[model samples]
Target: MSFRSFLLIPLVVFLLKCAGSAEGRQSGIFLPTELHPDYPGCPAVDSSLYYYPVIGILTHPGDGASGRLSNATGVSYIAASYVKFAEAGGARVIPLIYNEPEETLLKKLELVNGVIFTGGWSKTGSYYETVQKIFKKALEKNDAGNHFPLYGITLGFELLAMIVSEDKNILEKFGSSTKASSLQFIDKANIEGSVFQSFPPDLLKKLTADCLVSQNHKYGLSPEKLQNNEKLAKFFEILTTSIDEEDQVYVSTARARDYPVTAFQWHPQKSAYEWASSSKIPHTEDAVRVTQLVANFLASEARKSTTRPDAQEVRDNLIYNYIPTYGGKAGKGYDQVYIFT
Candidate 1:
């Protein structure tokens, strides 16, 4: 070949390589290697695709019938509203079963930027054992320079507090009230200092004023319960509190002192996805705004994470392709319905 012919061959090869990489990405077959620093919290915005994050929801172990025909064993029984709540902020929520090995969970954590511990009456003692390890893993990831976030809802909040405090009695029955309650934020809860920093004053007012949050639990940590415990007080910064419909007070919400971890005692999803008339879940304009605001805040935090999913590893571990189980009052509120494996 002539010198010009040799030069033409290199140019052709370069073009082919570039085209192949682009096609692989579009097919979700290949992930590009992008340089990212290991940092905690939300990382600087550079990967636009990751801005719309795929959040992982840790499924509680429940072996009961969900409905007449529907039942679940592992991570199959996620609430429709929890999915809706996440999607409100333009994020997709996937189920992550914790029965797997520790290595498996670490890999799952690496795939997603943020994770949520959904609310339910789970085997607290055994469950917290797994959560403690995952919590430590997330802390390690953040310490090593990776931005990872964790959110606990209702039972999740209780579990988080128990793990952080190592106090099983830190949680107690709050008269087992399931009725809605108004939230009262501590003086420190606001958009400037804590998780509510991006939240609007009017929205905060609506959450407490309209009583949009759903309280369905027999046990919770009261503010007094937290203040008296040295471990809990030092580990968690109480963000909000509320009195149950039965007049029993509980710590409504909290955040970690130095991590992107937040916990909520109320179900923000109920007002939007739960349409069970018998349950009396709120579904008003302001109620939805509450879900959207919380969703957006979590999604924004997930976006701060620079962790990208592995093409082959993600397929082998997470990402279950299943048919949608549409139930509840209005049906599942979120899009991208997934099936259980």
Candidate 2:
């Protein structure tokens, strides 16, 4: 063979090897069935009998008035974000559809370790009712000695509060308010109260004197409403009032108002501050800190799962090692990625 031909042959072989290595690293390259042929079935991880946690995320139905399907985009992004983070900490994440039948959902829930409610549009009466039933069932199961950890973000956060508090008032109070397009009422409240007017100490602490959160959602439990509703009061009493000093539940503008279930009004998945500092968008450092706190909180929750192994821990473990990517960026060793424009 000519010298040039021999050189080209070796170079082609090297290029092929590199391409194959790259393809192997990209998770999307594999089919779901190939990744886990027993999917929808309980499949053990690798050669070991051990299995990673699976997380079920509820998608937010988009604007019902607009006849839009639930905007799984944002929810999916956040879910993927948690999954990435959880995988990093040693776990797995599985996304579940909200429209699936309750029976199917429950079955899937059993196959996994936890559940997450993603944020989107306000849900209708039927959605709330269905959620209530699901919670009741879960509680019954827990009482029977089955434990599952749950997490909510934005809308999901509200759902978690409703579940623990069993207060239907959250629906009547903040539910409709989240449907508003702007912060007009919140702005008015700020002006009336000088932004530092003392709120309930517990509520104030959860909010942390951060006025920026007002920009995210206009509605929250008014002192008057909390004082008037016996059910709501009882719910809050259970979630926030009765906490032991040593309990580690982290309350934030994002997470729970109180309790093991948590929420985040802001999109931690967006990494808003990081994107903003890089001139990706206008952002505040506080936003970044909030997101990091969220990540840290999830990590903490995952660690707790080593002993508890509830649904939340199972979900957290799956997502602990997850890395964010975009497009087919999973090709770069990321389990998931955000598609932010």
Task: Using lDDT, give the best candidate's number.
Answer: 1
TM-score of each: 0.76, 0.48
Instruction: Please list the C-alpha lDDT of all candidates, in the order they appear.
Output: 0.70, 0.42
Expressed as tens digits, the lDDT of each residue in 1-341 for candidate 2 is 99999889988997667657856446336656667877775555454222444444543343221222134443334335445444443445655445556776566555554556665545556556655665565445545644445565556656655655556456422322211111112222332212123333443343334322312233344334444656545443212211112321222232222233444443444443222112222235554444455444444343333223366545543334444444322222112333211
Give the TM-score (vs. native) of candidate 1: 0.76
Stretches > 4 Å off in candidate 2: 1-51, 62-90, 144-147, 160-215, 237-259, 272-286, 302-341
Cα RMSD (Å) between model 2 and the true structure?
Answer: 15.8
lDDT of 1 by residue, 235-261 (tens): 788888888656777888888887888
Off by over 4 Å in 1: 1-49, 63-76, 188-193, 311-320, 329-341
What's the residue-level lDDT of 248 in candidate 2? Answer: 17
